[model samples]
Target chain A: MSIKFKHVSYVYAPATPFEQKGLDDVSFELKENQFIALIGHTGSGKSTLMQHFNALLQPSSGEIALAGHRITPTTKQRDLKTLRQQVSLVFQFPEAQLFESTVLADIAFGPKNFGYTDAEAKKLALKWLEKVGLPKSIANKSPFELSGGQMRRVAIAGVMAYEPAILCLDEPAAGLDPKGRHMMLELFKAYQARGHTVILVTHNMDDVADYADDVLVMEHGRLLRHTTPSEVFKDRAWLLKHGLGQPAASEFAAQLAENGLPLLPQPLTLTALTHRLVAHFKGGE
Target chain B: MTKIIIGRYIPGSALIYKFDARGKLLVTFLFVFAIFLANNWPTYLVATLYTGLAIMGTGLRAHVFWDGVKPMVLLILFTSALQLFFSTGGTVYFHWWGLWLTSTGIVNAIFIFLRFTLIILISTVMTVTTQPLAISDAMEWLLTPLKWVGVPVAQLALVMSIALRFVPTLFDETLKIMNAQKARGADFNSGGLIKRSKAIAPLIIPLFISSLEIAVDLATAMEARGYQGTSGRTRYRVLSWQKYDLLNAGAFVVLLILLKVLG
Candidate 1:
């Protein structure tokens, strides 16, 4: 397994007046190169769970094994650097983390911090900059000078430059235009294709349907379900009862089946729905 | 991380919470001044009892009050220890190398310690009971006379209120930045003094930039809403001098006078 969480629980400000249960008895495992989508309502501990993968937060109880490193509540600080270097986390609005004088330097920050020479780190940053679709001309410009979307891409490139073994992202495409969101999703998919584990926490069910291989549903600090998108979205009533919605295509296809169209095997992605409808019409003719 | 109780007003309907912010401010000022007038054990005892009563009247849990006093405990101890070892008067209890532990020194230590504790407690009670908005309003009203002498009292009050409001917000932002940097393999805890200071760049630069962005956005929002810095503005919640406010102020004044007479 690339990552394993065993009965992990995290409490913020434990033993204090503001103590909060961020995650409770959460256990799961992910294999190498698997694309997992974490779906939940706001404050449902999705971010809290993701932070554990890189040891940014230690589980208050239980343990987590990520990329061969074991993390528990008493995990030492010196040992966490290896875990962090192996599993990179791109936070919500990752653009907020960019702080170097230039875009190139900003992207090079992670690599250099992980023990790369200055020149090698800049080279890796330049390569990832192109991978994230940012032009090289802007590499010399200050990151503060870039647009919000462009700055976000630079921040993502900064993390990707280090080439972590397991990449975890929290709403990586939030507040982006449709094209930007599509490009980001495709970039993450490509990263996974290169044999790295990818865990994504997002509210967009369409992206989840299109990209996620496994769906982990979280609610009220607990893992409500861990299944494939096809299986999870098939139980529309159960998902709705839990205050979650199915993918747009899946819901639309379900409505068609209820109205006597009978698209057995509900379609999740738009392309799948279109193919199913085209086959139905062709078979009818 | 328990919301940093400093300068925070817990919402409640206790008698202390019901008192006007202006009255609380005036009483807190008088209480701080009265702390210095307390010279002997009896006066300090009365002062400490008054503080305890004031805190009790707020109906806040004893622990909440203790949490406020917790950080100052070390400082109080240090100040009292300094007085105990240094102040030279009365019958000497112990003679050490270049230091005298006398009965008067011990008394002086107790008096100074009680004075510090009483001042902190009174200020904490005032802040915990009164909202920042109310404090700003009371401040502007109290400082209105300064406006006659060309001081921008209203603007100053607004600045103070905004600063108070951002304390919790910036604290959260700092935590977020620290976590984000940690996720990127930035080890803040393991490094030495120089390495630790160097590691602060990632945390501080983002915080500074985000704060600037937030300030700009707030300024734009205020300008859009026609904020003109106290020019031709009317109060939404005007401060009124109520009966309880009068009582609260009168009670504190009487207590101070009694302490003075008794001391």
Candidate 2:
């Protein structure tokens, strides 16, 4: 099922001096089982929009349809556990949410809460632990005893253990090393391959280009565009206007095209760029 | 989380809002002592009238004052109920295991409830009308006499203001942490005492860690901004006494005179 929004808007501290329009009458339909990238600069309502996916923050006006549930401003917090079980949200710096004594226990937390038996929770936790690239040996250790990156993985695994049909992440790989970032992106890509929707919020244009089949571009509390990633990166002027960056490969291809070595159907990833470059040179030969 | 409007100030343009922060702070501090001066019905009535006038002067709706009283209502009722049940004297209404309701007990209970409610309402009036920054500034100005005793008044004032600011920040942090845990299917509100506490552990740990991180970051940022403590600093917000501020103090003096004469 697709997630749908109709005239959703969110206001922070309404009717007060500190009142601000967090999301301004946004509307979008997101299809299931696709990797969707939510891209925007700071204070563009990306976080606000992410919170709406699982009814963490209700719309100030209008309504949302997530799975079979209808969420309005009156959707109480108690009624949202079912929705949250279907869609897990990994907040920015998810590591800070860790409180379980052991990494294993922490990873099993979501599954346990979602009604999995201890054995079943443990099995899922161990499975996702290795899937997220953590060592099995670290499972017994206190989550606090692990490094920052390892703790982040444990926290991510914690939410992923229940195998929610939809996973929502806000900058999940932010602040990681480049190698770690690539591995995390690959994991998310693999998770999406299992026919579950993965909605990600990231500033990295390259990741969006690499993994995102759909791109939702937000600006100043408004959804500027909801289209394919290539279409989004195609407009260099719009990206520049919004202070957004380009995927390195597309940018390089654009420069190559400008220098009279055109690679048609612009490359979005390194692999695509390599193939395009090889074909262009081979065709030249 | 509790709706704590006790220390919250709503900014508005009113006569009470115009009173100098220093005078308001002083009056509020003395009012605590002044409440005790009301021993009899006449004195209590005078105190109540003064409190009523103060509330009216704020130009705020009654609900704001009601909110100030809501949090302490249970405690006041419980204490008043205890006094109503226990304590001895004239005409006995009830007798139990070493606890008896008497005429004097009823009077004391009523007085206790009145004193607590009036104190909360009047303080609420002061807090609601004055900005937190103004309160801190007034506190610093009032404590200036302690400067000769080697007190770090400016630093203390800075600490007090920062603490006041963190109250809201900590509350927001608590909310964020609670939501994060709730996303994981941790049911905080629908459980027995033990289960509820277990659910809340996630929130407290994260909140505690984040607060420490925030404090450290704040200290580093302050150092980066070259915040040297209490050295050659000039006041950006100066406190000056106005005619209305004098009227505020004068009004209190008149109330105290009335309280003494009538009680």
Candidate 3:
């Protein structure tokens, strides 16, 4: 599902002594099937913006729309529930959200919430568990007994069972080792291949460069930039000014470019950089 | 999500920080007692002026104090209404639906409202000036004499302090869990009472499970750090009675005597 924000602003503890403005006039749009990466520092409204995608939070003053549904304060409550089903969010430290005793029941919660029969929900849960590379035998085991990575997979599978049109992940790779990160990326790639839109909110630049088609940078509860990954990385000076930097491969390429080498073509990954170097050497003949 | 404002103490390093927690608690209790013992308009005026001065000296924001006292406004109004309709002394003013209104009823209503308002204001002042940790520490110290009864006051206070410290952390965790459940089409705010409660069940289960995990981790960390409870433990920062505390205690005794004479 495509998501759009129109001049949204949210203030916490409004009309109270401890009131704080969490988001300030944030306006951006993500088109259908766009793998958008959202990056921000702590309390920068990135999580707040993610909530708006599914109408989990209504903008205090402005507007949000998912696909064709306008999410406003006056939006019908029933409509909001339907919108949530269409747009699923997997939160940071997802393992902490697992509650059902068995991995199977935890993954089936979403489908059950959406009115799936018990059998249908369990079937959907098993399908997603397999999709996340978990064997069906582990389905009957308690979620709390699983390793951290397995628990995270079960939590993600829980959301995936809903077959949402759009999926938003908040720091999905946090606390994961390199191998776990690779597996998560592969899972997202597979999800994307199935034509579902993906929105990843993260602090890691490497993931953004490797997976995101477009990027949105946030600082201090305000949107700083929204553009294609290549374009965002090209403005290296601006990124640095905001305490953000290019992906490591792009930084290496930039150093080469600084020394009068025209070899790096806005490289986003090490493999791409290596291929460019090989092509340059071959072209030297 | 925000509860009673009066119960929340805005952390600061003002002059009130110097007073021992036990001294402050005793003084505040006496002050509240004095306010309640006030008799006629003259006594009420004296108590009101004293409380106003104490509030000003505490350096609390007047607006915040008023906000904390706002919830009591309804109770005050209801009490005023009861007194206005039920009192039977002084010159008769009006009558309606078998209810008689007299000048005394109006005066009594005003008096009761003012009296309760003063009590509430003084209590708010005390709480707003003292942090929860200090309050608990004071409680533990005062209840120290109760150790003869074999009470685990220190343990109780530690549990309370830890719980208070984790309030914000748990609040954040709950918000995260709510968002996660909401994302999965768990309609929390939009259903029948039973359905809404059912939706919340999932949220609570996850929150409780996570809290259990956190508790385990915290216990492990505490044991690893050699925590053996308050017994035989020396505090890095200890509360010692200062000149101000002594002076404050003396003032409290004087206030109690004065209140008794006026009553």
Greater-lDDT candidate between 1 and 3: 1
Scanning candidate 3 chain B in windows of ten residues, the lowest lDDT window is B1-10
What is candidate 2's DockQ? 0.37
Q: In terms of TM-score, how similar is model 2 to the real structure?
A: 0.82
| Residue A77, model 3, lDDT | 66
- DockQ: the better of candidates 1 and 2: 1
Task: Give the lowest summed-lDDT range of ten residues in model 1 chain B.
Answer: B1-10
Q: List RMSD in Å for every model shown.
A: 3.0, 4.7, 4.0
DockQ category of candidate 1: medium
lDDT of 3 by residue, A17-123 (tens): 57777778899888878688998777777887787788777778888877568987677667676777878898898887788878999999999989899999999
Encode model 1's per-residue lDDT on B91-138: one tens digit a residue.
999998988999999998988888888888888899888988888888
Local accuracy of candidate 3 as per-residue lDDT tens digits, B1-263: 22223357865666766677778787777676667777777777777777787677677678867976799999999999999999988998898886879998988898888878877787777687787877888887888988879898878878877787777778888988887877786767776888877778878998898788788998899889999777877755467889888766766666666667776
TM-score of each: 0.90, 0.82, 0.86
**Model 2: lDDT to the true structure:** 0.89
Query: On a 0 to 100 scale, what is the lDDT of residue A176 in model 2?
Result: 96
Per-chain TM-score of chain B, candidate 2?
Answer: 0.79
- Once fitted onto the true fold, the runs of candidate 3 whose alpha carbons sit more than 4 angstroms away are A73-78, A235-237, A254-262, B1-6, B11-21, B35-37, B55-117, B147-152, B190-193, B236-254, B260-263
Chain A only: give the TM-score of model 2: 0.97
